[model samples]
Target chain A: MAEKPKVGCARPTGGLVGQPEARQEQQTSQPTKEVRTMIQVGKPAPDFAAPAYHKGEFTSVKLSDHLGKWVVLCFYPGDFTFV
Target chain B: MSVDSVFVHKMWNDHELSKMVKGGVPFPMLSDGGGKVGTAYGVYDEGAGVENRGRFIIDPDGVIQAFEVLTPPVGRHVSETLRQIQAYQLVRKSKGTEATPSGWKPGKMTLKPGPELVGRVWEVWKTSMEAD
Candidate 1:
């Protein structure tokens, strides 16, 4: 069997790691940025690469890798919270 | 499909989420830890600190064919999603010249878009409906 990929999370508050608690708290309290530009239909989707949980393991997923195939990109708020 | 991290996803799958989601989540549950994906897709709610329920279906060419964002209280219907995928697949196979009607299934009649079809769709479609 292949080795499972490591899973890392964003540290609460701000940047990746080791930010001050105040900063973290500020980040946690800050509202999500209101994105002015919305992706439109009949246009290319924004590309992204991120770790995904799949079949009991961590793996990487990229939007570009699926260029020739159909993709269903679902964005839910959170897990296990009436999702 | 959440802003939760992979770690949270793993934990949830190991515990509560798996039970609530019968047969498991068939596709990958991507982690948008920084909400980059959510922001790009225009579903992230900054004030609420959570993403709305957003679904996008991309065609083989990477163009978004259909997308919808719903409030957190309402859950999406999986069967309708499947039907949409089928409909879009049919249209793609037809080279974008055909379109699926409402509640279209694979075997259902499809419409050809043109000036000739204008204002006469019901007459043409009624024949197929009667056949059904």
Candidate 2:
């Protein structure tokens, strides 16, 4: 009979610790950062305010203007990515 | 998790952004054109145009409750947004009677909170994650 693995022990199957691709895949799956200091949970989000296209012209936007509202600040590269 | 407004880094070109309005997708898109907002948000990739995919969910009271940023190459998980939104609502509304376990979802059991509930929380967290 095969020995049973203990609780919190390694999985009996794939994605083993020695697999370098699996490890590399894990890192690659996350957001890449040029700098080492990656922002994380509980950290204060950086603030931003820029020109906004309201109806026609570019109106300015300040982060503090909406002090009491939920802001989902998202930044994307250019105008048209498949993103 | 849940937010009222989304301020995308960079300001947009009026004509270009207006073009997107012709499409079906909803939600305002800001174009951090000058990189000012991108710099402030830490989403600026100087050599790159515009900004990196940085997302933050700031609450009504100006507290950043949750944030997510992705590199240009990776796709952001919208499902996680839904999960976090539901979890935040559940925890905030429940008055500390329960705590959201890992990989929590809507209609699932949240562990009873407090020091007495740590073991139970871990169990729930494990089960939910396994199911995830």
> Whose DockQ is greatest here?
1
Best by TM-score: 1
Which ranges of candidate 2 are over 4 A from the true structure? A1-40, A54-58, B1-25, B95-97, B122-132
Candidate 2 chain B has its poorest 10 consecutive residues by lDDT at B1-10
Residue-level lDDT tens digits of model 1 in A1-83: 12345544543211212223334444654432433364899887877666777877777677777889999988887887774
DockQ of predicted candidate 2: 0.16
Kindly list the per-residue Cα lDDT of model 2 for residues A5-75, writing each as its tens digit: 23233211211122233345347744223222434555554444434434433244555567765566666
TM-score of chain A considered alone, across all candidate predictions: 0.58, 0.44
Minimal lDDT window, size 10, model 1 chain B? B123-132
The parts of candidate 1 lying over 4 Å away from their true place are A1-35, B20-23, B126-132
Quote each prediction's TM-score: 0.79, 0.61
- Candidate 2 TM-score restricted to chain A: 0.44
Lowest lDDT 10-mer window, candidate 1 chain A?
A11-20
What local distance difference test score does each model get? 0.73, 0.52
